[model samples]
Target chain A: MSITRITVLSGGMGGARFLQGLLHGIAAGTVPGVSPGAEVTVVANTADDLWMHGLKICPDLDTVMYTLGDGIDLDRGWGRRDETWSVKAELAAYGVEPTWFGLGDRDIATHVVRTQMLDAGYPLSAVTEALCRRWQPGVRLLPMSDDRVETHVAIADEAAPSGRRVVHFQEYWVRLRAEVPAESVIVVGLDASSPAPGVLEAIAEADLVVLPPSNPVVSVGTILGVPGVREALRTTAAPVVGLSPVVGGSHVRGMAHQMLTSIGVEVSAAAVGLHYGDRATTSEGVLDAWLVDERDADQVDRVRGAGLACAAVPLMMSDVDATAAMAAAAVALVTDRGSVDGAR
Target chain B: MSITRITVLSGGMGGARFLQGLLHGIAAGTVPGVSPGAEVTVVANTADDLWMHGLKICPDLDTVMYTLGDGIDLDRGWGRRDETWSVKAELAAYGVEPTWFGLGDRDIATHVVRTQMLDAGYPLSAVTEALCRRWQPGVRLLPMSDDRVETHVAIADEAAPSGRRVVHFQEYWVRLRAEVPAESVIVVGLDASSPAPGVLEAIAEADLVVLPPSNPVVSVGTILGVPGVREALRTTAAPVVGLSPVVGGSHVRGMAHQMLTSIGVEVSAAAVGLHYGDRATTSEGVLDAWLVDERDADQVDRVRGAGLACAAVPLMMSDVDATAAMAAAAVALVTDRGSVDGAR
Candidate 1:
């Protein structure tokens, strides 16, 4: 039987770009040298969506939406191109409460509509689907949770003895530029939020699960925070393959290195794999395969030592062709092995 | 007795500009011979302030604020100059609701603060005061009422035989551009909305009352709709003078002609004086003094015929000098009569 469904666990820019390339590759039927009909499903992080200026902003979701809809500002890597700010400037003059985060004019329209629809009783999953209908992002996009789950960082400040205060992820990432080292990272409302509709179903039904090189902590970690999500990943019959976000010892973008250090994890593919260790240390089994950059070939044994099968590949998604090679490698890892438990 | 205070009945744009010139001329002690320390209180029309894009946009108030604060876009004559629209563009791409009217970025910041403060339990009058503190729009700006008194136009549509549907003034003004002739005009909530703080006091204790050449029907008329305001204008121990918005047979700005026609009043200075006709037509009494444009000099007796002392003067308000000259003329009209009614 031919491999059909593919589920991608993605974060923001890096993950979105990778998925764009992957979708392109898949559409061209050259991703993994496979035939057409590879249904792509992406579980996007929703922890970055925040209400600012009386607008409901879903940063990650919008990034994905705009990127896929051909509306993304290629230069900014976020928000729409040719956007206006007549509204925001006016709001500032009125002495609006929070003048911190910047919300573009075109971006505000999205939030207003999303907020209106959500307020009118549509579940987030349904709303995402409805929004996707307009963009036709090609691949099915799913928010990690139908309910609210915000990622917050604990930072040291003079106000607390621990010098710590919790800030929304965007406040830490965008506003503060992640200057203050975080003591801990917490995904708020995780305990109550359920996996978005079709999320687990997509994971369980996929022939292969691909973890794009997104920020491992906030993106993938936030996704797994949803109830039944980690459980599904562990028990799903499909083999899971993850690309390392860390090519060397630093993140491709953002302040992920500081985030990794804050969480007491070394910025390395080996450390990341170990964090999601195999059955020996995990209540649930680890990833069946982890793709590491050729530069880190010497560290593959560390991943193998953790009982995770490791492959050293030129995992650098330098271009569309290069990204397709990486995606094909991921599919090959699962297809060549048939199945994690030899079920195939 | 020294002339201690000045009360001005005003509308947006034209009224605001005229007020700015008057304020400048009075403050610099250059008004073709007028008293110094003449306190100016502007009774601003709140009829055009509508809730759009979740913002309480007061066109009249913002006009006065921007003009007086030296932030007004002289070219556009509304909103700030050098504004951005990154937020609005983003909002549009996201398919936000209510994308009809444009809101600028700088403009939006003002709304955001206003909305937040309003949500935080501050009344609009206090909010306007706080906002003015930043712009320092010089004169005390008082809304006609603290309540939600919106100007609605009865439009004829296929939905009704009378084609009569009451819409917010902004919707009629900005959205439709007043293409449809108004069947009737309704200032909703005015019946219950009491005059804002300082409104009655400002009119009751003024040395001279000047009605800026604003839209008589929507602006000044809306102010008159507020309870006790008309009475104060009639019985105040000061002269109430009005400079007509209409010159000859045309309004300087807006669809004032259509609005005037809705109330069955011809679009002329003489007609506007009759619309504010003395106690015979309005218990609030008519103009104690009326100033007509040189082009409408022939209509001075027509205004006088409406039971008010009238003066044919140059009321073009081309600049500070001209506006100050016109203001002096209005004061002279009242001063020459030497107390039309001693009871007032």
Candidate 2:
């Protein structure tokens, strides 16, 4: 029996939670157990990392990292648990510029080491590797790019000092609370930065690709910005599966509704499925199967009409066990497809 | 009737400790009770700042800042008092490089913000200014230069692969415990870096200049490496005074004896006095007056023979009050000189 390697493209909290469930499911021997154990690869988004007070902060990557490595602050949804703030207070006393962002003391040690390594000319992947040695995130976590690519939002603030401010994703989410209307979203440095080492290979060789209930526009979308990433997904023989972040016209977490509206996509699972339509479905891109919640069963044919395999199931990942069940369902769908292909 | 401005050329621990006493003495009305208060400008060494655990740790400046701002760790001799080590434990768990240097959770915050600001394009001087605003050390403290000048010690290693090695100052001090005999020391990056803002004016206008009892080979030597700093000290008309760091043949703190030996200077007040010599005393280099401990009173003629106005006082700053008394004596020497110059 050959190993079935599962590849996941993830963002922050939601994706991390789902991956946790997937890992749990694998451990419980539920999700189509593969011989020689299952290999998991997480291609993470670095778009959310912003330089605040001179430290590189990647919210999404760290979330997935801490969650998988068992170092995450589950209560805060970001940073490490049992963190301190001595350095923050000291910095505050210095009246250092850009004092808005709060860096915890324990959290600061990580940033200090990361910044130090970066200054010493280590790439983000190598630094990530060095950091992950302790967390052992259970899977190989790769940043979309070793180079910097910050996500920026263009706001129509005609009255402001800068007619349009290009704020980093973190400033939009963490500082501004996503209150300002985004006229356009831009991922800076995408044109220059290539995908990290082994990223495309992992995606290409995976038995199945999973896009855990992450924000399609920023989370998965930013990962797609990496050169060769989306192309690998489109051309891979493996079936691609995505769990909808939208449930009952609302996001599970974060201000995904505003982001969806900014990109002209409706805040619905059907719209989300259509947004990532089958290459054959709407001449948009590639997506083999689209899964929605049981509540949105009425939108099943609409999803099928988009020219892809569609399924409506209990998609609420209520707990670790439930999340594994969701992952199991997706795996079952891909396995069923594999058998059909084998017969052909 | 007018406020007198005092400028001091400082090294690290001893210099900073002396400043602490100077402040205390002035506060207690021990130093010529002038109205509108006295202003002090401290030109500090950048040589001791090392890139440890990937942080630009300026031991001297931070010592002065913490000491004056009332945050100095009383027992540790470096870093803030009451700092936690949870971050250090975590960093160690990750098997981070340079594990020997202890960066407390509280201290790590300072490094994080400093690294961040440095990445964002602010010069070290501006960064120091911002840092001092919080510490409010009550003195205008400035780095000798905005340039990167790392002190590297050339060591003759016999037990290993290479017979000779250039180790960073911290590696030599903290890691190797300075037991390894040093061949020579190099202040890297000093050739291009300029003296920080306000350094020259402070020296030119100063009524008195004092070289605090810091390490002559590295701490003060590094400051002199900045192109114009030594020249400014050389041409200043104010009487220059220095308290000897080497007392009765032993360093009060640190491995100054080892450093002095490496630099080919004997660990004695007489050798340090002659090292500064008449060039620092007669017309322009550093001073007209030199203060040695009462134990070295026999060397008064020896110092005077080198063309410096010499005085032998009980120079042991054993306590805060004693330190203040020492500072008062330095001021009295300067005042007497100024009065004599006025008569001329």
Candidate 3:
């Protein structure tokens, strides 16, 4: 298949990194089935979106935009490269709440513009498109939903605090550092929200869909939790493949371990593949193939047994070439399976 | 009579500067008939308020806070000292509107805080009090009204590409530099606006009332334009005095000349004094006395002929001592007149 249109279901750091490498591969004509002229569309999770000091901030969308636009701070792996914290400092001096979140001075421009557009009756999807005009992140980025959908982490609160025990995903990840055991992840407002404009269309028309090494539970999970997105992934004619965020026994990076533990999934690559299930046989499942790290080659048989086409590859996205190689491996796995199915 | 509570109707830069000098004079006990520990309440003009980049910015309110809190940039006469412009630069890069407004990185915090509070169901007056907890701007700062009241300038625009030829006050002052002829000043929504919670009460309870050398057509004018504010000034038992913003044939500073001409009033000290009218005699007028600069001393007889107790003093606010002397001259004029009334 000539994969001229590629769709990526993404999170923040991990997804942004993978998309960067995938873009580099396409530019180098190295990602299998994907031509250098391929058009990429990113369906970003907005469950992590927050309203701070009256500005709407979408962490995942901004991370992807900044990273791909070459404006990201390489050291911090997020936010603007030469960002200042003058606004942050002043906000603190004023003793405003939720000072823990990182809102850099340069990054604040994105929020200000987005918030202004939102206030002027533009949908979140259109606002995101307007923002990308400046970043030119090389892909069409659409938010998961125009309506609010926040991920809340329900944690055991022995301290008897005044507010609800279930805190915002940001308070869990950024403030608490996910120290306490999470009871469960609650995808608030997801049950009522329809997908944002062009989200399901991108999924249905894609040459192939790939789930990058993002948190399957929160990042990808929250996107899937939106009513029509998961259904689109399951019913689309295009093949679907996922790269394991879990390498050997841990996530490549981020809170995947804590999230998986909360959802009662084992902390292994095979377990993650099985958690997604197989798209070919399972009635409502959404995975066609799964890629694991080379060190987790032992899990390939276990993953295959779960009715998924499985491949083991070096999956650490340390650099563009290495991550592109991993992207190439995932494409090869799904395409090879397609060929075998055709022959059968 | 002891001047225990003083209320001042003020604009942004000039009014704030005058308030600072007044506070200094009160603290030094240089102003006669006033004690060192007097409570000051400032009724600030809100007509210059603008919703730019989706944040509600009150230029006058912030100027008062920044100046009195010792956080203002002395050279610029407004905004936070040691401010950065990273947000402004980034916004310009994004091509957002109102690129001319100088929203410094540090100053953006105040807007952000105020906007958030306004969004969260708090009135502007309440929000100001909450902000005052941080800056401690000394005097009680009450917005002219809780309801929205924007000042619009109708200017000659035979070449306007969009909308009415009328523009916002900021646009007229900053963008057009007031070079074009202004037809009239419109205080939109002022008729429907009630004074913010403490505004009328401040005037009614004040031991003395002074109108600082602020723009009479917009700053002080707009506040008086609010439905109940003008009535309060007319009925208050406290002696009302005003310092002429117009120094010689032109304004001491700001766009008072253009504004005066817009309303068909002569741009002179005596003209401005008569425009306020004589509160002691005129049944509905709002000023009992008016002060002119030593340079405009020649117009003292002209002002007295208009039924106001006229005084000539050096009105140059060269420094704290000079400005405090101005404040002293203003208070002495009102108190001396009050003693004559008492003897009668």
Best by DockQ, which number? 3
For each candidate, the DockQ is 0.47, 0.52, 0.81
Q: How high a TM-score does candidate 1 get?
A: 0.90
Clashes of each: 59, 6, 0
Q: Between the candidate structures 2 and 3, which one is better when assessed by TM-score?
A: 3
RMSD of candidate 1 to true structure, Å = 4.0
What docking tier does model 1 reach? acceptable
Residue by residue across A13-83, what tens digits does model 3's lDDT show? 99999999899999999887788999999999999998888889999999999999899998988899989
Interface RMSD for candidate number 1?
Answer: 3.6
> For candidate 2 chain A, which ten residues in a row score worst on lDDT?
A335-344
Q: Model 3 residue A282 lDDT?
A: 80
Candidate 3 chain A: worst 10 consecutive residues by lDDT?
A335-344
| Global CA lDDT computed for model 2 | 0.78
Q: What lDDT score belongs to each candidate, Candidate 1 first? A: 0.78, 0.78, 0.89
TM-score of chain A of each: 0.93, 0.92, 0.96
Native contacts present in candidate 3, fraction: 0.94
What stretches of model 3 exceed 4 Å from their correct place?
A: A161-164, A337-344, B161-164, B337-344
- The window of 10 residues in a row where model 1 chain A has the poorest summed lDDT is A335-344
